[model samples]
Target: MSDTAIEHYWDTLVTPYELWAEPTSARLASAALDLIAPSTGSSVLDVAAGTGALALAAAERGLHVRAIDSSSRMVDRLTERLGSLAGCSAEVMDATKLLYDDDEFDAAFSVLGVMYFGPATMTALTEMVRVVRPGGVIGVVHWARPVGGGPMFLPLARAVERLDDPEVGTLEIPVTTAYLEGPEVEEALRGAGCTDVQSETAVVDSPTPAPETFLAELDPFFGMFPQYRAAVARHPDRFRALVAEEVRLVERGENGHPVAHANIAYGRVSH
Candidate 1:
C-alpha cells in the first residue's frame, strides 16, 4: 500500500489514541530526530512526515525541509504548520513511489514510518535511496521488537495470531521482526542497494497516564478500523475492561506511574 493509504488509515485511529499516546509519541519522534542529525541549510525529505513533528525539528535546526505524508489530512496540517515558517514545505506523496526525481534531496529521514509498510518495506527503502544525492544520507527509525516495556497489548497480538491473518506478525516480506537485530537493519539497507550501511539502537521513553485514563482514551482506536472495530464491537466492554485491568496491574506495581519505552533502531545509507 502507498504511504497516503496508510496515513488515511491512521488518521482515523491516531487522534483519539494520540490523546493517550502523545507522551510516548513525542519521545519517539525526538529520539528519531536526534539520530537523524540534520545539518543547517540541508535539503531534507521527511517521509511520512505526519503532523510535522520531525519536519518542524529539522526546520528548527535551520534546515530546508520538504516533508510528505500519504495522508492528505496529515499533509494539509503539515502545510499549515510549515506555512508558518519559511524553510519548510509539506506535500502528499507516497514513500514507495516518490514523486521527486533522483538526487533530489541532500538527506532523507523517516521516524516510525519505515516499519509500517507491511510487505512493501524494501520498495519504500529503494525509493528513499533513489531520491537522495549520491553520498547523501538516509536515516530510518523503527520501533524495536518485543514491544519493549509497558503494558503492551499482548492480547491483541494473540488475537491477531489466533485469527491466522497474514498481516499479523510479519512484514510485507513475511519476515518475523522478533529476530530484528541491528545487523538485520543493515541487511535491509544493503538489499535496497544501499552501500556503507550502518545501524544502531536508541532508547525511547515517555511518561503515560494511569491505566484507567489511558484505556478510556484508547476506546476510540478499537473502532477506528474495520477489523479492530469488528473485534471491539464483538465485545466492546470486555476489551475495554481488559485494557483497563492491564493498566491497573501495571500501575499498581509501580504506584500508578507507568513509563513506556521502546528500542528504536536507526539505520543510515551512504551516499
Candidate 2:
C-alpha cells in the first residue's frame, strides 16, 4: 500500500480503538513490560507509539518514556491523553528514520505497530535498535496468526484473497502472528545486534464501537481493492449484511469480545 493509503487506513481503522479499548490495550502492555525488564528511572523510547498505550503504561510504571509515531493524528491524541504524565511525551516521527542519537535510550519498544511498514520494516527495526543503549532491551509486539487471530486483519485478508492476487501469498506485514512465530523475528533482532532474543504470546482485546462504525473504519483498507470498494458502494445493504455475519462469527468465540491473540518479542542489544 502507498504511504497515503496506509496512513488513511490507520487513521480510520485504528485511531478509535486506541480511545475506546483501554482495558484491553493495558493487558498487552503489561505483558510487554513483563518481558522488557524495565528499571526505575530508565530512559525508554516507544517507536510507533499509537495513542501512547505502551508509553503511558511505561510512564505509570516509573520509566521515563519519549514516544513517537508516524501519524500526526495519533501523536496528537497521545499528547492530549498523556500531557499530564511527567515522564512521558509524544511526537510525530517516522519509525524507519528516527531523529535521535545512537544509543540514546536505555530501552525501546513497539506494541502492535510493526506491521504497517510497506517494505520498510527492517529500517524501522534497525532504527529501534540504534536508539537503544547496548545491553538495553528492545521489545516488540505484533498480532498473531493465520488471519483468524486479529479481527481487524480478517476482513483485510478475505478482501485481498477475493482479489486473487498471486503476490498476496501471505500477509507479510509485521503485525501478523505468523511473522512473530517464525525464526525471522529473532534473526532480525540478531542482525540488528540484539542477543538473548525471546518472544511469547499475549491476548489483546479490540472492541469495536458498533458494527456500522467498525465497517466504516475498515472501509479505507477495503477501498484498496477495487472489487471490494465497488461491492460496498453499489450494494450498501448487502455489504453491511456481510459484515454483520462476520461479526457474529467473531463474537461467538470471543464471548462478544474482540480479544486478539498477539506475540510479544523481547531482547537486548549487545553492549
Top-lDDT structure, candidate number: 2
- Model 1 shows how many backbone clashes? 4
Cα shift from native, residue 250, model 1 (Å) = 2.6
lDDT of each residue in 1-271, candidate 2, tens digit only: 6787667666664554564544555678889997676998999998888777798889888999999987778788888888787777889887888999998999998876764453676778888888888889988877656443255655444443444444434333233433556356666667667889987888767665455565676554455555555556555676566566556666676423467677787788876
1-271 per-residue lDDT for model 1 (tens digits): 3544546666665465345544555566677667667667889898877776678778887889999877777677678867867768998777888999988888887766765665678888889888988877777665555452233443343343344443323111223343257677667777776776667666544444555565455555433335545545565566555555655655565422344434444444554
Where does candidate 2 clash, by residue pair?
115-174, 115-175, 144-177, 205-259
In angstroms, give how far residue 113 of model 2 lies from its true place.
1.8
What's the lDDT for all of these models? 0.63, 0.70
Worst 10 residues of 2 by lDDT: 169-178
User: What lDDT does model 2 reach?
Assistant: 0.70
TM per candidate = 0.76, 0.81
Q: lDDT for model 1, on a 0 to 1 scale?
A: 0.63
